[model samples]
Target chain A: MTYRTGTEAFIQGVRTLIPLTPGVIPFGLVTGVMAIEMGMSPGMSMGMTVLFYSGSAQLVALQLLQNGAVPVAVVVTALIINLRFIMYSASLAPYLHHLPRRWTWPVSYMLSDQSYALCAVKFSSGELGRFAPHFYAGTAGAMWLTWQLSVLAGVYLGASIPQTWSLSFAVPLSFLALLVPNIRGAASLGAAVVGGLIAVFAVTLPYNLGLVTASVGGVIAGLLIESIRKKALSNASTNDVEREAQ
Target chain B: MSDLSLWGMFLAVGIGTFVMRLSFVEIYGRWRIPTLLSRALVYVPPSVLASLVLPAVVYPHGQGAFVFDNPQIPAAIVAAWIAWKTRSTVLTLALGMAVLWGVKVIAS
Candidate 1:
């Protein structure tokens, strides 16, 4: 894509992110409050908003810190929690690999769950062109800005919010909202079941290593099932071909 | 409790997170990962999300013990069903919070 065309793609990407803002806003608000409750300053919270830019990881880190976990522990926990971003980055690489290094760095930095979702939708729909990275940059940039602002709002308001309302449930509820529909296939079911059991059993692991282990275990189970399924299908096809020859 | 220390922690987290994210791009460009590794990546999100959510659902405190005495369990279960049925983040959260608060008030 030409420079002029890429510029348009960037604008298109920013537009797609607008609808996602409302969903991100409340999550960020919760993260900011959680940080404050954990004894972190507003500046520190906002810095996390800008830098980490991940609501789930930020919330998990805050809780870990509150538990008096060491810095290494907190960081490792967040990394394990966010390991999926590597997959997201890899998925988008084909679309964005040719972009300038400066372009790739910031765009990758801004990538998150919602932005990646939007990008995937656009890319699959054929709406995205060679300048798709520009579009992604726009979507991610908007999300990043809105996410930071929402956290800042929460930091200012979290301390004053009444305790009568239970906001803590919002976190798990959000995940439930995201997770339930995804448990569609046998692969997903196997993964979730194995992962859940492992997490419950390994909760005592320091720095939430149970999370990493459970995730690895779940992924392994899912992949194994899928591979077996593929192999079975291939074998059946070969047997059919032999019968036809007879 | 120290302000400077908190900022230091924030910086550490922020920098650490960035470096971790950057690793996927920097390393993967030169080295190709196996197909099994790629397939495993797909399950990471669900497992990680479950790990994050289960702890909060089962134990509000950092402890390993379950809080069956608390109402958060029923509230969360109801909310989980709502989430599954409607697939709406806002509604699920709102319902869960309302139930949790209502239970807390009645119990207390």
Candidate 2:
């Protein structure tokens, strides 16, 4: 499928990002506040905004740091939490592999949730070409700049904002926003529920290993349920075919 | 721990994260991921998210007690409802902050 026009595609990509910004801006703000509370300077926070560019991992790292967890532990937790991005990046490789090395690094830096989603859709529609890279680059690049600016602004405001406000809630709220749309399948829902239950039971684990267990348990349960459901459906279908033959 | 060696640790985590992000694309560029690995990756987001949010909202302090003494629990419930109802991240956040602020005031 051919994209209509280069300019139109870029415009459309930017438009796609508009709806996502509302969720992203508040997350950026929360990250900024958490950074300050965790004893990070604005510069360090800005660095995080530019380098990591992940809301979930950054929030986890902030909490860990605030608790005085060892740096190694903080690093490890952040790594594990963000391990999903590797999948996202790998999935997009076919779309992005054509770009020059100079552009690749920057594109990789801008590969957040919104960018990945938008780029994945665009790439699948056979839109990889000269300006396609720029379309994604512009859209994601715009998001990255806006994210850092929001965080920087929040860091400044964080000093004045009272501790009672609890800007940290913004983090989960952002995730909640994303999670709602993705909960379309029963398997995914079951996984989430079972995962939540396991997490509650294992809340006392140090450095949040409980998170890993909950995640693993939920996935296993969901896979099991899905397998059973698929088997039942296939058996039913087979029975119908046999009845027709008879 | 060591006087918040801000820059040093920042550099370490930043580089580590960047390297990790780049690693998958670099290694798997030529090969497709196996089916089992694909299935496993599917559960990472929700499970990790649930794990992150559950402990914080339910038993935030790492203690074994499961009481709703903290305002985070009620606030999170209210926030989740608003998020589900409106599907508006901005609204969810605004309402959540308001709920948290109200709960904090009452509790304090």
Candidate 3:
């Protein structure tokens, strides 16, 4: 409600993401556990965290890399998985386009699913001006810190976790937590079912191309179904109007 | 997939993803995103997460085909339901992990 400094905006941003902290912690731990379990060198695995900073893409790359996929495929999958950020950035661009290059670079680097979600709503609320970038930086920084620390803890605890525990299942469980709430309608449900089925069916494709195929197929299905539903709803309303007129 | 190649994947993906993020931040309002692309982006999270989720829970890595053989499948089903109902990530994790461990003990 009041004009805020960059530091204040940053603090405010971190505050907004506090409730989501528990959700983020497990995913980071799962990523760290997977990196160690995959037999990656500790430094290399940590390097992946620092370099990629994305749990989904990191997990995807880890699985494919262990599967002996090519470098190009692995990189492409990571990039493809992160394509949503481009859209997020586009939406955020209007609020932050005026920022200096020095500020914009770091802000872009820290973009993630959680930060984008939190900031997108905030930015669109018209509360931000030049200080908006600071708020985003705050959310991203909090997430970055939590993720790295959790990964480190997981890496340190990698040996003692015990194999029988089936801890790796947490990765998918985390993803399920992320996905379940988003299934608001048939389009999303169609997207999930079709995309998941296609991923399995096309598993034999070389270089992890099946994953890419599934991503594209699922998005297309969701979008198509969404449009169809919209059309159906409009048509139904039109019919209702005609009946009322008679 | 070699050690050296792992580094390559890291560097390549790191740079590629960074550039993707920068594409919009740097361009900002100058370049417009197409309507189709905007619409498609909304579905990306569900699609990407679903693709990842199904494989991890069902096929896993070593398992052959997805049957009731893997403990993760049932645990994930319960987790999915918990997530749907409570919509709490912590509960889903705690309960899901508990279910998974319980199954492991009993199945053995």
What's the CA error at residue A59 for candidate 2, in Å?
A: 0.7
Model 2: CA > 4 A from native: A1-12, A127-130, A235-246, B3-9, B24-29, B60-62, B104-108
Return the TM-score for candidate 3, rounded to 2 decimals.
0.91
Model 3 alpha-carbon drift over 4 Å, by segment: A235-246, B61-64
Expressed as tens digits, the lDDT of each residue in A17-130 for candidate 1 is 898786778787888877776666777677777867888778777766766777776777777767767767766666776766787787777878888888776665656666
| lDDT rank order | 3, 1, 2
Docking class of 1: acceptable
Candidate 3: residue B58 lDDT (0-100):
75
List of clashing residue pairs for candidate 1:
none
Pick out the ten consecutive residues of candidate 3 chain A with the lowest summed lDDT: A237-246
Best by lDDT: 3
What C-alpha lDDT does candidate 2 achieve relative to the native structure?
Answer: 0.71
lDDT of 2 by residue, A157-200 (tens): 78887765666666666666666655546666777788888988
lDDT of 1 by residue, B1-108 (tens): 477666666677667666655555655577665666667767666666676677767877756887667787888888888877887777787888888888888988
For the predicted complex of model 2, DockQ is 0.46
